[model samples]
Target: MDVQIVHEIFFMASLIFFGGMVGGAIAQKFELPDVVLYLLVGILLGPYGMNVLNVANGSLTVKLILTVGTSFILYLGGREVKIRVIKRVWVTIFLLSTIGVLISTFIVGYTSHLLLGIPFSIALLLGAIISPTDPATLVPIFKQYKIKKKVAQTVSSESAFNDAVGSVLFFTFLNVITSGHLSLEHSFVLFLKDTSFGIGIGLLIGIFGTVLISQSDYGFLKNFSPIMSIFVAITSYLVAESLGGSGFMASFVSGMVCGNKVYIGMKCNLENRKVQETVNETTGLILRMMIFIVLGTMIDFNIIFNHFWINLFIIFIFMFVARPLTIFTSTLPDGRADWHWNEMLFMCWVRETGVMPAALTGMLMGMNIPYLSHIVGIAFMTIIITLLVQATTTNIVADKLGLIDK
Candidate 1:
């Protein structure tokens, strides 16, 4: 709004963007995950260090940048979800996204209370916020690690869908903690409503988007294809939000259907690696970089340090227990009974949670919701650690465990 803030926003955005490019290039050169370097850039500019870049209120500039960036990233993440692959591993995906999240939330929540002396409600909120892996930060390594098809599908499916599940649970729990009137009956009713409505909204959008593309002439639509998809994604999110459904799920489903839907006489033209699909992948790439950079600059390390141990414990559980249990259980149906322990281990620690939940947590905190800051701060810390630790060593771990092909 102010002239000074505008100048500051440009300056900060440029710095982060340039930093991300350098970090990304180096990470790729070294074969380390780029996400780790993005986060390292975040740490350098966050409150713990120079504090040159910060996420604050009263700025539409940052919000606009992040909103578009996040939407495009979510859509790209959604595009990665292949329905046919998921169908084979649907059982595993469902269990991990729903039950796995439930288990991790309770584990982290109860453990936080025991370990951090926090109230039960605060601990539970933290559990819900950081329960699911974020796909934006996972897909890069999914390609690098060359994990089995089933394992990769399961991880992507769960990551794509679990955000909606975790979000519903987070808000439901928040209602209970804030209002103190969340009965079992009320909770079940809310859960059913959220899940049903969210899925319905997403399905409807997916079907609509698919039909739109199918009926159009690709010959005439090439230039407009990207814009059309963006339109569909944004409208789906807004519609779902208006109806109190999960907009995140809606955007994802729309992209999923768009990615997999067959159009009459459409052909794959890989002449340009960036524009191979029916949708424009270049826009997706731009959005991904923008979102992660903006998100990186948003990290408030001071707040994280205030509650470092609590964050670490949550991260530990996710890395060592919840994710592994979900991946291993998901792989069971593939009939790969003789699992490579190292491959499984690499898959377990492959991905980390990221910007969406952090953004939601920040929103909740701004609303004066109790314990919101603690939950958000903890989630950010866990994301940073997960990206830095897991991304840096996933390849080494895979090789040491003899999972990599010679």
Candidate 2:
């Protein structure tokens, strides 16, 4: 890389960090999520708006930062999942992450294809891209509102796991579209293989990390446990991806195991707790700021203008019709989940598109897929609208439903 490019990257990073601090304060004052404000700032200063921070959409630096940021986000999300909570809501999380994603994907895909006259393949790709909820976006809202434990676990776990599912489905549909063929058996096998391997890699790494932490003899080693934890998280993700597994799933599982101290057979001590808190607070905040800003920079005004009505229509259907239908239908079966009516309704409205979809859309743009511009435009619009609408109103909805902690 050129020296000038390196300097520019650092300059941009400083700007993003500064902007995020200001945006977060403004959001808090207005009782809104910081993510919405961060995104708006990005759009305002990004190339499309003021060209103040002109990072190329397809640049290696952007992609590298996004990849690292996404991995850390998933790792932190996984760490948030407690074993007891998972045991309580495992069935619900499983159903919502898998069947629920499919339900939303097909409904949105088929409906959009019919309404917009786009090919079913392209519609499906779009649906898969946007199917998974983003924990990076939601975890903050959950924390800010101090949402109910059960509700938070369900949302966080589903978001973390379904991200892997959504990625698998996205690629599966992408293949079908590119090759002009669809095979259910083949797709299922691929999904199973990717998910299982990813989980397996994560378990292995998690166990190793737990044992390492447990055996640390020196105070220095104990203090270094947090750094070791981060190392394990990132390594698990990269190693799993290199082995044709879901890196997202691997990272999530690693964090979950390490966070719960499953291998060590103990609760996290104060130092360990501080490590987790500091890592989650600092890393998550920085990554989200960078990713959302880069996402804003990628937004093209012309495409949004050309497809304005269609974009609005798709967002409407996904948010209101498809998301609600998926939540109710998937969780309706007895013994599926422990959600009451209010909880279910809150969950239904909690679907905000975030990092995963934005990252995947960027990848899709690189693939030169059919309707690439439209897909990117729609995906970008969905992120903005969902963050603006759902994120902003999330606290109020929680309060109304009494899901917020007193």
Tens digits of per-residue lDDT, candidate 1, 267-372, equal 3223322343434555665556665666666666677788687677667876687777777766565553344566566667766777566555644644666665
Q: Judging by lDDT against the true structure, name the best candidate.
A: 2
- The TM-score between candidate 1 and the true structure equals 0.85
Which residues of candidate 1, in runs, are more than 4 Å off? 1-5, 57-67, 215-223, 263-280, 328-343, 401-406
Runs in model 2 with CA error above 4 Å?
A: 178-181, 215-221, 262-269, 336-338
- Summarize candidate 2's per-residue lDDT along 12-112 as a digit string, tens digits: 98888888889888988987888888888888888767788777766787778777788878888887778776787787788888888998899788877
Q: Please, what is the whole-model Cα lDDT of each candidate in the order they appear?
A: 0.68, 0.82
**Considering only N, C-alpha and C atoms within 3 Å, which residue pairs clash in candidate 2?**
none
RMSD to native, candidate 1: 3.4
Displacement of residue 84 (Cα, Å) in model 1 is 2.4
